[model samples]
Target: MASDHVAEFEAHRPRLFAVGYRLLGSAAEAEDLVQETFLRWNDADRDVVRTPAAWLTKVLTNLCLNRLASARSRREDYVGIWLPEPVMTDDSALGPLETAERRESVSLAMLVLMEKLTPVERAVFVLREAFGYRHREIAEILDITESNSQQVLRRAQAHLRERPRFDASGDQRRRIAELFLDAARGGDLPALERLLADDVVSSADGGGVAGAARNAIRGASRVARYFAGLLDVPLPGLELRVVELNGQPGILAVVGDALVSVTVVEVGDERVRRIYNVVNPDKLRFLAAQCGLVARNWRQVIEDTSGSVMELRAARFRE
Candidate 1:
């Protein structure tokens, strides 16, 4: 019976892993957390655990909480702007839950904001809001008083509610994404200027190993001027390809034989709100396998973003 129960528990692994990934924002760490949860089950005296799922969740959440606490220093030292690991999936494979996760999961703004939350706070809120876990169930999983769980969730929600909701259904977003790609890759300054809002913000993450702009670029004119200078750099075989990132259209630059960088455009109505360039090799691990690479090298120059501006170079891994 115990063996049977354990097998049954394995069936929920994907859902649990997704939960952990959503909270922790790292696929590798999420896998570790789920494995640890099951390990506890294997070692436990079954007579004590009345609810197996609850027990698993409790173990997992606590383990993640500890990991998150210890992870602060490493994240602080992370190069440039840190972006979420991009999950590559064809649109057809999306189930309702997966769709929801992709929509909410990869939002750069949302992910950054989540960093402000304590691990327990994130756990409580995700359990309650995303998984429909009641406060009582959440309390059991978190090993906190039900009221405490409720309080924590409330505080977490309050912090997250301030960001403007992203609407993914608009055609303007897709159209603008295409326009931005044309402008950015073709070196059409006028086309790029027309697409960008007057007050646009651009940020890049190059892991500091590469010469990326140390600060965020604000205002449309500055970004335009910067990109104009960038396009002049000699990247002979590089081309822009459109793909969906964070549930929206994005552009990736394939340089020579490697996919070097990804550009995510956040659109507001018909205007471009934000441009995020991910040059940090550490953040692109999720795409490593897809790029047919064996190991990721953070220092190699895969794409040159700093043409004449500040001499920034971006790299991605190739097998």
Candidate 2:
């Protein structure tokens, strides 16, 4: 019975982790939630639990909802733009991302947009949109009326309706990213400008330890120049690679023993609409570990470093 129970819990671990990651935007936190769920499941009466999957989903969702409530306050005072910790993921991790509707739910851009939602709304949105939970089931899981679940989901969707859709396929994303990087590297301002949306916005998240813009930079011309200037003043020892982050192709940067930064773009009509740069040391641990490096503050080592943007140095791109 004990072994069988463990097997049952393991089968649903992926879905639970998916919900936790989408809700909280932290892989470590998601794994922790999975552990917590297992603990509770171990003690749960298997016969009464009836549906292990549903029970686990409810437990994980509520756990994430509580965390999000507390997290919002902290983020308000965060050192810089708080982009989601970029994770190397695929459709198996975030569900089929081929369709805009499915992909949007996992995109870092949408996850950031979700930060604007209330905890209940965020839970409702994640459950309904990403997991395909029906309103009645969500209501049962959340302990809310079915109609209430529907309304909350509606409100959440309305808030997110204006965010850009991720329409580019994997090949297009890789091609566009290569072109953008090549232009930025060669300092070809015109080529970059042509690839940027008129209302393009770039956000940097260095989390104070690393040097980054304290505020977001917006506008096509401004953003294009920002990247050009960034290339003109590159950080030293920065190595770059192409990785799938948050279900999309993105650039990851590692400097020395630290994961310096990650940049993921949202492309529409074959042009970059938004660029999310995450440089927070706290958020780069997983990636650093993946690259066999330590995610630490190397900024102190090069505090006097000048004429270079601290986010990255001369980058080497690997597919």
For every candidate, C-alpha RMSD to the true structure in Å: 5.3, 4.3
Lowest lDDT sum, 10 consecutive residues, model 1, at 310-319
lDDT for each residue of candidate 1 in 1-319, tens digit (9 for 90 to 100): 8779778778768677767776787767877889888887788887998877777777888888888898777789886676565544344211133544446545565666788888888888767765779998888777789899889988998888755355645366778888887686678878888888898888877777555676889887788777765555555566677776656667766655566677788787577878777766556655545556322322354234324322432321111
Best by TM-score: 2
Instruction: Give stretches of model 1 more than 4 Å off.
Output: 1-10, 45-50, 89-102, 168-171, 228-231, 255-257, 290-319
TM-score of each: 0.80, 0.89
Best of the candidates, lDDT: 2
Ten consecutive residues with minimal summed lDDT in candidate 2? 310-319
* Runs with alpha carbons beyond 4 Å of true place in candidate 2: 233-237, 290-293, 298-319
TM-score of 1: 0.80
